[model samples]
Target: MAHNQLDLLRQRRFLPYFFVQALGAFNDNVFRQAIIGLLGYLAVSPQDKTLYTNLAPAIFILPYFLFSATAGQIAEKLEKSKLIRITTAMEIAIMSMAAVGFVTQNMVVLLIALFATGLQSTLFGPVKYSILPSVLKPEELTGGNGLVEMGTSISILIGMIFGGLIFAVAGAQGPWVAGVAVILLAITGNLVSRAIPRVEAGAPDLRINWNPIPESLAIIRLARKQPAVRNSILGVSWFWFVGTVLTSNLPTYAEVNLGGTPTLYVFALALFSIGTGAGSMLCEKLSARTVEIGLVPLGAFGMSAFMIDLYFARSGAATAAGLTVAGFMQQPGSWRIVMDLVGIGLFAGFFVVPLFALIQSRTPRSELSRVIAGMNIQNSGFIVLAAVLGIALQRYLHWSIPQVFLALAIANVIVAIYIFTIVPEFLMRFLSWVLVRGLYRLKLHGIEKNVPDEGAALIVCNHVSYMDALILAASIPRPVRFVMYYKIFNIPVMSWIFRTAKAIPIAGAKEDPELMRRAFEEIDAALAEGEIVGIFPEGALTKDGEIAPFKSGVERILERRPVPVVPMALRNMWTSMWSRRDGRLRRMRVPRRFRAHVDVAAAEPLDGASVDAQTLEAKVRELRGDAA
Candidate 1:
């Protein structure tokens, strides 16, 4: 259990895998960019260069479409570390051919090798993501994913630079340099793969499907088994789509809009890539080491904001041509453009990492490899569509680069809204996160130790403030179906959040027996379905800054369900902004202890059949101590 993501890099479990994937990404980009550099080395016509540039991506992506299903099956059937070694070995063979293509300056050889590289990548894709869940705990998923994304992004940027520079820097020796570099990278990745510890097969007893089409469709169905997982896959594919459009337009965008040479295109890309890496690194800290999908909405809108700003920052051609990156920076509005590029990249990171973690954590381990495979296939489709759509917008519609960007920004908003609407959990979590983080600095004690990671359990916490549910929801890694009073459940805008979170609304027997019965039924059903149900037991927000007597509802539920009961206490929340200490229930008041230090403490699970309300209340009191 490494507390920090970087700490994983210091350990054998993660470092080897990280470098293996990073090296693969580096070599992949290096090989592709080297082919582009070859256009100059071979002195091809501009038309030929354009044709090669357009054809390379399609050639590379074709294998993902063709072999992802078979690849997924192979990944599931073999042990993870062994599969990785095999992929790295495949990479060495593929890169060896690519080296010949470079040395002989043969375009056809390079294209065939490029397709081989894609096939190798397609095979690696499932194991690349699926292995993470096996090696990392649920708490470590976000950080681990962040590190992977960071490594891949930075590696891609550096590889692009290194690959593109071989001809420019080495002059007559460019071919040899390109040839040697890719092979060495492949060898390095292979060496790193050897160090990744042995991991059990995702489905060791499973038989692989040799026919790709049926298996591909079957995996796609598997990927869509759960709505959240399905949408997560869609979200990842959408990320690729956005990235494809953005990256494809950068060359022209740089030359036409910024009036810069080829160097500026790389510079702009560097800014975006660096920003993405930085954002990826931040996910662990922002998410509190949880697979927090709340960041997805934050990332989504943040990307759109910067993209829209980018369009406004530069909507027309540059005043001059052939300006260097330095000269381009000297121009007015350049810094804004720089910030926009970085911002879009930063938010894009925020958007994608959580979704990946969600897909990994939520999907069952046995099927995860194939799920990842299905996602890769869909991602390839989205990338191809994005390239084609972007090209169509430019060539057929004659849209300027800025206009294309503007359309992308608008499209992003629509897509985001649609996804969030269909899967309100992403948005629900986002709103809860924002409300909790905005109001308090939370400290958790015994939560990881006491709370069950899976299966049904009743979470009994003290009713301290209006924000208690949000705080607890944000603090706990798993989703909890909070049981609240009908009034609070219908609290204007707060009602929507509660309903979306699937919080059960109850009333006192005297107030409405029907609602109370319905609430009990829902709670029983939820627990029966292996879901966490949270209840205050005191049945209302505490009017005084003291714990109230526990009600009999807890006893009744446990009597019926006989599930484990987790006693949790919200400490120091009595004095917080949303508490009733202001002499009213959620009254508007002047700031007092804003961003207050609030503690959520939990005790080990009590046997539901044995524990009484008074015992649970006393346990919660001990956890809370005198903090209230």
Candidate 2:
């Protein structure tokens, strides 16, 4: 069954990225189409094609390599919320410039407009990536990246189609509609960007270096110092490499290699981008919102494998390589290429999404812009290199287009092996991933009734054993803050889990007075801010089949905060996971009810202003009431 990745796309935070990108895409298409149409119109008229058509792309792309170094430095040096706004404002200016060209009917001015748009995009490159680490969690990184990429490709497709239709239909009056459309979309993009939250730049104090070549190299060097970060950036760069090669040549490939009309180019690009969008959203679902680095190699494997198959699908056909959209659909041999191309696009989703999450999770927040800048540099380098490779292999090497594609496919495989070997995190995750396949089927009873719908509630649960926190964390959709013992908080691998969950650590008053005070302070602060905070009152491990005495500590907490207390009982813990023989040995096996029932019983708000400790203890005991 096909998974629905679109669920993640519905998030309010993601909407801005989607709208902003789509509008930007629409504008890009409007501009490109204006130029392309003008050239095509000139083909029949007196104007020369070489002057306008050849110059547009070069003018646009030159800014990325030229200004990316400075842009990266600026993104790192300023607050990201402001930088994104500035970039979008730049878009407004760029679009306005294009509007002038369209109104004045000057090709030279329009060419300059394309250059301004590229410059805006270049400045945005580092800011876009760096901001994600600040806004999203580690697990969300890959899915977010995927969505951004998918949205971008889809926008490109829409833009191209829109641009052509508008130009072909508008005649000499084309620029007015196109210009107005670009300005409106750019304005919309700017508005959406204004909603983006502030993100701290990684290197606020790092000195700006104006020289693009040297600064770009230095950013690259700084990025490599972090191993995992460097690899994740490489992963993204390679994606751009593959993507640019495909996007740049697909139209040419359809026209020259496949003997197809211009319409098929639209079909091919749109389908591929749609496939990527689907894949990006699916990453969160596939990885369960964790850093599933393992999928990196898996995606690479499929990408390479499918590209080779696409090559095979196209090779045996003797018919026209490119066909009109209608003509291509009618041919049997061409359908194989179409299906193969779709598959290639679909697999791209799987391959690229996780890398985004990895970068966010692994890189230092302060150096994120520098790291992202390094990534952009690599991406630009790869784009140029891939274009060169694709064109050179086709023209100089005398290789068929399909054969050159085959070389790229094989290269993906080789790169996959090299990357996985260098970073075992990807491979190691696949091993543990098998356990996740066991499937967690939930059975709920009185969960909604027992758990408070709103208001601050201090949950007092009997911490029976393993995964107590994980179960509670997963069960409630609303975020919860758990006040855990410092000992448990410092547990070797669990620290990261605790950190991500935003767990607060508490120590016994005698053991550490300062920490205990901090915990209480945190409790009051959380409740005052109208957030949910939980506490487990049973101070120590339940060694035998008996409830430990309720700690007076909870009473003290309630006295100060005066919030409701939710009493929770975890079913079947002592029988399976209690530490009986010191800390080294285990007790009974995990309960047969591994999916045992849990009841979060919310009693009334405590009588904090007047109640004695004994009264509060009695209230807690009544709530427990033989539940476990």
Candidate 3:
């Protein structure tokens, strides 16, 4: 059954981990903000304040660069639950030290504590993500990631708000109050971490690498070997890069361009965060509870569009001073700016959730944590580079911040084109989404419980149209290897999509024995690896919109390697423009149907040894009924 994203919050495995991570994020930001606020309260020199403020973010992110590789190794080598508990304990200790620094006003202790907190966060990063797949079902992964992203965003906001408010109200004793609060939060996090179920080590026998630089490079190399994992890492890192540029400039942008005060800054941040939370929650609905990469392209488009609009919205505006939040809200064109920020964030959620889910779902369990760690390292690198690029563009190139927004927006287009081109699977999936959801309304019957969520199963469906495979491909959440006639597989524009999807192209034994042999061999290999394989028993598109006679190929394949066989039927597709009812070539001359209704019925899996091509064909024919 499909459950709401919020439903996971009630489960023990997910809820405990969620709060622990949320509190940890909350504490990190609170402590960091408390330090900066303390500096301001002390009336520190502007030069010194600037130096420390600049150094704070760098110090915090440095651990991701210095320790992420090692973190991955440790996470893979140790039980994740225990590791998380240990890391949470470390957080408590670090916060205790920070509390001392806060009370004594000791800069050294505070900075050291800050670095320690960063290191602690680095250690926790791998375990946090790697444990999810172990705890949740595959169908729950998208929802799980959505909740995590939403939690983190909201936590950052709350941390900032409370950290500033608490420090100000406490006055001279503010640090002491902040210190105790953080330590308590850390302790609470540790207590929650104890409730997380133990997950076995991913790579228990792997050797640990002590060195950072070479190990980090090696980890990245290992992740780069898988094209999907590598591209997802790039996409995720680019998100952080763009996000850092936009967020880091908000304070100055609000003051100089919009003439807003601190409250307006908070309002803008809230809009972005709220938009992200809303968008993340919407991913499951948009994807029908699947990890849909199609949303990524859609998100990238929205992010770029809103960013470009933001550039125009603020462009050529007169500078204003002492604008309160209420005053800014009352100004002309304020709503446009607000909408642009929110829309950018909303699309950002759409863009990011799927990439994270893809990384989690696609990467091998043994290497998932390491890949995520490499992603963290790259994310940090991109964030730092964004800072540098922003500085250079502003100082050397003399480009305004809004102009930089324009430049980044343009860069996003190039990045999207390059990514989509390099891995056409993303674009192919987007097209499949369009064809299945936009061009036709798909209704699935008995698919939820009938189709196994994991493991190898053979799906046998009656072929009614050339688009049968594409429809099934988009409809099924798990990636499938389709077995299709070689000629159809080689269809001009679709050949690229077929190849990208790793569709197996087969020929009849009499026509081309070699291709048939290879196709069966590929099918066996795919099923052996626990992948789903789909085949049409009729071996051709229907000529009269009727079920064709069953062939012996299915029986022969099952004899070689037995696996459960699922029977499916596609109804109401024979009259579609892509169908062969009017003759394949003649159908192409007909106008394409839009918003056609298609029903896909999948029955329970039959024992492979008991089922043959004839029985499966009858089952599918019955499932199809008189719909055609």
| Stretches of candidate 2 exceeding 4 Å from the true structure | 1-14, 44-55, 103-105, 198-206, 211-213, 256-259, 316-323, 333-335, 438-628
Number of the predicted model whose lDDT against the real structure is largest: 1
Q: Which stretches of candidate 3 lie over 4 Å from their true place?
A: 317-319, 445-448, 509-515, 543-545, 571-577, 580-597, 622-628
lDDT at 620, model 2: 57
CA lDDT of each prediction against the hidden true structure? 0.92, 0.70, 0.88
Give one digit per residue, the lDDT tens place, for model 1 in 1-628.
5778899999988899999999999999999888898899889999999899989999999999999999999899899999999999999999899889888889999999999999999999999999998888777889999999999999999999999999999988998899999999999999989999999998989988899899999999999999999999999999999999999999999999999999999999999999999899999888877788999999999999999999999999989889998899899999999999999999988999999999998888899999999999999999999999998988899999999999999999999999999999999889888888887888888777778877999999999888889888887877789999998999998998999989999999999999999999999999999999999999998888788999999999999999999999998887776778878444746447678889999899999999999999999999999999
Clashes of each: 0, 8, 0
TM-score of 2: 0.70
Which predicted model would earn the best TM-score? 1
Q: List model 2 lDDT by residue over 1-628, tens digit each.
A: 1122354466555566556766776678778877777666545444467556546777877887788778888998998888878888889999899889877777788888889888888888777777776665443565667777777777777788888887688877777887887888888889998876556667788789888889878888988887777887788888888877777777767776667788888887877777777777676666655556656776787778778887887753336754678877787667677766776777777777777766766666777777777777777778778877877887888787677778888888888777777876565454323322232322333334445544677766666654556545544323468889898888766665665556889999889999999998998898786666877777766666456777888778877887766555555334443333134454345445453444444455554456544565566566557654
Query: TM-scores of the models, in the given order?
Result: 0.96, 0.70, 0.94
Candidate 1, clashing residue pairs?
none
Q: Rank the candidates by TM-score, best first.
A: 1, 3, 2
**Residues 99-193 of candidate 3: C-alpha lDDT, one tens digit per residue:** 99998988889999999988998999988888888887666788889899999989998898888776678998887898899999999999999
Clashing pairs in 2: 141-357, 142-357, 202-366, 258-321, 258-322, 259-322, 260-322, 260-323
True-vs-predicted CA distance for residue 477, candidate 2, Å: 15
